[model samples]
Target: MNKYERIKAALNFEEVDRVPISLWMHLSENDINPKSLAESQIEQTRKYDFDFIKLMPFGLYCVEDWGAQVQYYSKSNQPPIVKKPGIESIEDWGKLKVLPAIYGTYGKQLQLAEHVSRKVGGETPFVQTIFSPLTVARKLAGDRLLLDMKENPAIVKQALEVITETTINFVKANVNAGVDGFFFATQCASEELLTEEEYKIFGVPYDLKVIESYNKETFFNIAHIHGDKIMFDLVANYPVNCLNWHDRWISPSLAEARKRTDKCLLGGVREAPYFDGNNKKIRDSLLIDGTVVEIGNHVKESIDSVDGKGLILGPGCVIDQQTPERSLYAARRSVYTGAHTLV
Candidate 1:
């Protein structure tokens, strides 16, 4: 099957020739320079034969657009931090300026996606990443937002409503730009950060609203849970076609997740400790075998133990900038080989 067919089938929880695969890489200078990050991503997908390519433009863009100071870091690390929470007080919420969706960081990503889709000519699926409403609220308010959730519950809810509306608009813009789908990542809604009750009250409702707007043919929405293993139930219940999370670090395993929901599962391998070049001690690190065969074997094991028809082999999270190409290629090899057995 072609890349588009493979991903479409996986998202619908249908059988395909093999499990589809995607790589989540940051829009860093390494991938962005020379050919532009989007162009480079397409080149990499074509070169390695990945089913999907995820574009995670730095998160600071949204925060910066809200008037926070941001500092771009050296190429070695992820993008710079949005120095202060953009919304300082409840009063700031009144003055809260909603920037145009196409004016800030997200717009740049859309441009890149357009270029890639045109370049690839529908052969590959292009996906753009967006912060979940609650996640974006936390980034804009930091610990203050969490405190407000307890101290000033009303204000928090009010702010989330506004952010959720903006997020829906953002998702719509991406769909308009011809992105094949979206990777909706909820970073701060984890159990460690918020109680299940809190997630249901604040996170899930708003996310469902945002997703409901774009459940059309042009978009395959994937909900990503960045942390909080205990909250698998919350993630399973989220209104999305696919579910992705950090499977390597925390698990009832993908097999257990399969029992909870029939949504397509997009991850099981470790991205940072395994794929990142900085951490060599881990067994799956690039230094271990330096071939796709090693990485492919690991991914195959995870899929074989779960439901292969609904599995998408990928790093548990975004691949760090310095991750070896070989490690990523390993994932691609695993997809095509259709090898699911542990041996």
Candidate 2:
């Protein structure tokens, strides 16, 4: 079956010719320019021949327009780091204003999206990465986000409204860019970061607003609950159709998650480490000679939990940039009817 047919069947919990598999990683070195990032993403997709493409827009591009001091990295494997956050104090929240999604850093991403859509429009589906409003606020304020919510909720809520508006605008722009869906990622929906009560107050309302804005037009939306101690019950009920998270590394294994939600699950291969040199690290009880992605039938076991329907074989999160090509080939081949070998 074609990519669209395969994805549609999996989304509807039907038999697939081969389970859809996609892996994403930050291409920081090429993400600085729109054309550069677009070309890099196209190249990466062709290299793996993935089932779908999740646009990697310089991990911190969302915060770049909001006064974030970003430090770009030159290494292909290294991610760009945030030098300083936008919101430093309660007063800084007052300084926040709604920005246009089609200008500045987000504009560059829009161009990247458009370029990708034009190149791979009908062949392979692509989704843009959009952080939840609360997640964007957390990325802007850093560690003090929770404290600001408690001590100065009124100001924080006001800021969130502005952020929500911007996110909604961005979602609309991406929809116009011919995106198949969005990978709606929420990094703040973790117990280590916020309590259930706190998230209900600050996270849920804003996240829904941004998601429901384009939920109708998008066909392949995935709700990604980032980090550990996740509020699975909370985000599992989001309007999105697909579920992605740190599955085996955190709570609620495939069996448990299937019992809770019927959203097409997107994980199986444990993310291989970033092997730059010969520092072989043990992961998933496998001795990696730096050339494998979950070298076992782990994919089969994950699919068996859902009876091989409504599942997409992939890494829990973005794979390490330095993960070897042979490893990715192995992961892609794991979903097919053959020995997981590189041709």
Candidate 3:
């Protein structure tokens, strides 16, 4: 089967010629320009012949036009950072205007996706990365969000409405750009960040709205719960067809997650060499330093978990810019060398 058919089979839990495989990382140098970014993603996808192309524009592109200040390192291996936040006080939340989905940073990424879509055509499945609405709010407000959500629930909810509406419009635009689905990441869903009750009120509702907007037109939607101690069952039960989290570092290993949700699982490789998932600082560095053999083992173990059914081999999050291409090649080739012992 081809990459597109292989991914669809995995989503349906049908037999695949081999487990579908894909991996993605940031292109620090070219991510600022849509043409360059699209070229880099296409090159990387062809180098390893990944089953899907998960478009990786600037990580903070979702919040840029909303007034969040960013600092670009201009280094080939370093992604951009939020130097200053858009929301300083509870009142600043009121200032966020619903920017057009085709303008600013968001517009640039839409162009990248459009380029990738036209290039890949229908041969390979491709997905766009989108943060949950609550995640976008947290990026804008930082730590002040917890307090605002408590003391100023109404005001916070209104801002979330703006964020959600904007995100839904973006999703619609991406679907029209010919993406198969989304890598819908929720960076604020973990226990270290929000309580179950708090997320249920703030995170889930807006997240579902952004997702439900395009679920019907997409086939490879992945609900990526981004940290440890996550509200797993809550997000896993989403209307999406797949679930992804840091299965290697966090709780509920791939075998365990398989027991709870019937959705396809998309992780095996580790993005950071040493992450305990406590939101701890790792010397301000995050990258995959694993050897090719270790990466092969990650693929081996991931396949053994679900007998290779409903699985897509990749890291829990984006891999590093400097992560060796050979490591990714190993991950993509391992599926051919090994097969799951289906029960």
Q: Of the candidates shown, which would achieve the greatest lDDT relative to the real structure?
A: 3
Candidate 2: regions farther than 4 A off: 272-296, 338-343
Q: Tens digits of per-residue lDDT for model 2 on 140-232?
A: 988898889889999999999999999888889989999999999999899998898989999999999998998899899999998889999
Candidate 3, 1-343: lDDT as tens digits: 9988999999999999998888787888878999988988898888888889888878889888988899998678888888999899889988887777798999998998899999997988889999999999998888899999999998999999999999988999999999999989999889998899999999889998999999999989999999778888999989999988988788888999999989999987667666346966553222255555665666787888899898888888877777766766777778985532222
In angstroms, the error of model 1 at 272 is 3.4
Question: What's the count of clashing pairs in each model shown?
Answer: 1, 0, 0
| Regions of candidate 1 where Cα sits further than 4 Å from its true position | 30-35, 217-219, 274-293, 338-343
Rank ordering of all candidates by lDDT, starting from the highest: 3, 2, 1
In candidate 1, what are the lDDT values of residues 1-343, reduced to their tens digit?
Answer: 8878888888787789988876766755553332387776777777877887787566655566666777676375567777666888866655555555776665666666667767775777777778878888888888788877887787778878878777776777777778877788888767688888888888888888877777664557788888744577777776678888887767657888888888888887767444336745555443134556666667767777785778887877767666676666666677655543344
TM-score of 1: 0.89
TM-score-sorted candidate list, best first? 3, 2, 1
- Could you report the Cα RMSD, in angstroms, for every candidate shown? 3.5, 3.6, 3.1
lDDT of each: 0.72, 0.84, 0.85
Residue 182 of model 1 has an lDDT of 78
For each candidate in turn, the TM-score is 0.89, 0.93, 0.93
